[model samples]
Target: MGRVSPPVLPAACEVLVVGAGPAGSACARTLAAAGHDVLLVDQHVFPRDKVCGDGLIPDAHAALRVLGVHDEVMDRALRAAHVRCVAPRGGHVDVPGTLAVLPRRDLDDIVCRAARAAGARFAAPWRFVAPLLDGERVVGARLRGDGIEHEVRARWVVLATGAAAPPLVAAGVCERRAPSSVALRGYLHHPELAATLRELQIVWHPRLSGGYGWIFPGPGGTFNVGVGLTASHASEEGGRASMREVNLRRMLDTFAAVHAPAAGLLARGELRGDWKGAPLRCSLGGARWSRPGLLVTGEAAGSTYAFTGEGIGKALETGLLTAAALAEGGDDAAVRARHEAALAGLKPRFELYEKAAHVNRLPWLADLVVWRARRSPRILRRMSAVLEERQNPGRLLSWRGMTKLMFE
Candidate 1:
């Protein structure tokens, strides 16, 4: 076999999207489909590994549909009818929703291919070095790859760089130097275990007070298993409070030791590659959304949720929002205003997820919520609504919610 050649980069494009993950791919697809020149670049090639739970909820399905890749993704995913939320005290509740699991290695490639098919020029192994600035405004970017450097000047730039601070800082849009949370994940191949585990399993235990663990069934006989921990929590006075230090690997081991299902899965299954970890920027407050002639979307703008660590959906949504903002003919100020407004509209939901982070701090809260959910279908339905983004998670996971559950 002969070595394949690298993708060619254009000297200039109408829109330059850095980071070809869900957010960048989504934005590139939207813009390319709209008949604009879009160049999508990433540091790694397609089929690259990403550390994630690989659970796709309703919102992710909706975003996939918008990109016209819902069926394609579903075809390769392991479908689940609902998620089994296991509480600290062994109490559990099944919350119904449209869910699936497709590893990031495959899921991200499908989305990126969709963008290319939509006419977005893609180049891989090209990492963003810095912004090409013109008097405090971003005009383009400088990319380094293959021991060489290239520059692309565009009318607008979109940063979809996920969770990494250096690129955001170089672009002058970083707000938080540290990630809001972190997660470690790996795959296990056990045909018997994968065949029987029908629904996604998320466990909360005292051993994982700073986080939770999940075992999601994936394509083939593989399972995506992991643990995620929050770095901070929302204070009573509405400020950020740091959590105790946690060793994620020890946390994962503890999860398996404490949760029966996870224990069985870990014991019997053959491990795939080594465990991979990544940082998460959650709660949508990490960086400024827009500046003159530029916009930041995806995890770089804190698109991941606090409690669930679900970001694929919101990243796609925000990327499309940026595309729409730029597609509309407007001045730099006008485009910035539109993008910022759209992001602002989604802030309340993220804030609610942050409030729900209390469950991570106090695992007993999960026990109480699950106990209530097991008895009341109303509470169960509301929990389902949370997955659908129709109900505020803060409302359902609060003291008020506990009182309501008691009376009901």
Candidate 2:
């Protein structure tokens, strides 16, 4: 029963967005800007900590501009023009592009505020309990907050709850999938590293296979350091084994000690807090986009880039794309089909990234690419395009592009 006890209020809106992160905010702000009434809800308030590397590449910059918060974020976060990638053989290449390091606490608040500023009603501490259904179609969501339970009815429910797999799981659009990749991130105060930090750095570990570590310069004198291992790499030591079997905690500690760049920085600073880890469900562009009236966006829909484990930009992009579809003002089915068709545009790039995720396992290939790029300005620029997401992930798969990348 979609019941709300007495004294619990009921509200109706055109659209109800489940999470206030980048994807939800992007969708709500766009919808509200287009003259639709939107109510955005979240389980937590703004300015709270989240486990992320806190690095924003060029694609993220584009999303912020669409949200009208690009200047706000850029004004606060430190900037860089290049990313330093170190291969397992210790060779390095500097890929030119704009990047920044702003903590998730700050970034999420900026986006959420943008949504509110756009006239979307904001509600926090309201946990989405389940989809309020009319037969088979979702009409809204049952929520719990303030020691009371209620339902917020809307024409459509947007699931931007992210990696938690919340509303989707409850509504039976999906299940709690396992760890396709594992990541742990923490902050550190390193004034020395901060003073000289000009670029975000990534390092490929020779023995970790498909895993990489990163050091991003955060606001103030802080640095964000972390490691990630894709499922392919995780299953290597033991079939279908978890993070424990891979000794993820130990691996991060070892990388921080021996990975030259990371070691130097950690040695010069003290840890800020305990490392936070999370499992990810990557690009599910292959899965169902919508069932009835609910649509999943962001990491919930698998918009993450498997190769680099990057998802923020894709999340925001997909959110805006979804907003466009919903704002078309058609019936639910038409809106869903439109959104599904639009998402197909992301599949080619995702398939290309799937191939790159496999290539990440080979140390020699990474070494060759980095070494060649270091020697070839054209190749270096092209490689940078890959990170900036300006170039398709498939570009490197082309014979012509590969020949230039190898021989130029």
Candidate 2 residues lying further than 4 Å off, grouped into runs, are 1-10, 232-244, 285-287, 397-408
For all candidates in order, the CA lDDT equals: 0.89, 0.79
Return the lDDT, model 1, position 221: 89
Candidate 1 off by > 4 Å: 1-6, 232-244
lDDT string, candidate 2, 1-408, tens digits: 333333333488889998888899999999998889999988886667878777898789999998899999988998888888888878888888878889989998999898888899887778888998999999999988867788888899998887764556786776434556778887888887788876888887666676788888888888898888875324334343334356667767777765776777667777888778876667654235787889888878888888888888888999999999998878877999888888888878877787777555765667777877777777777787898776775566444545756665
TM-scores for the candidates: 0.96, 0.91
| RMSD of every prediction | 2.5, 4.1
lDDT of 1 by residue, 1-408 (tens): 333345678899999999999999999999999999999999987878888888999989999999999999999999999999999889889999999999989999999999999999999888899999899999999998877789999999999989988999989998766788989998999898777888999998888987899999998989999999885432323353443466888998998899887888789888899988888999887788887878999999999999899999999899999889988968999999999999999998898898888898899989889988898888899999999999988778888876777777
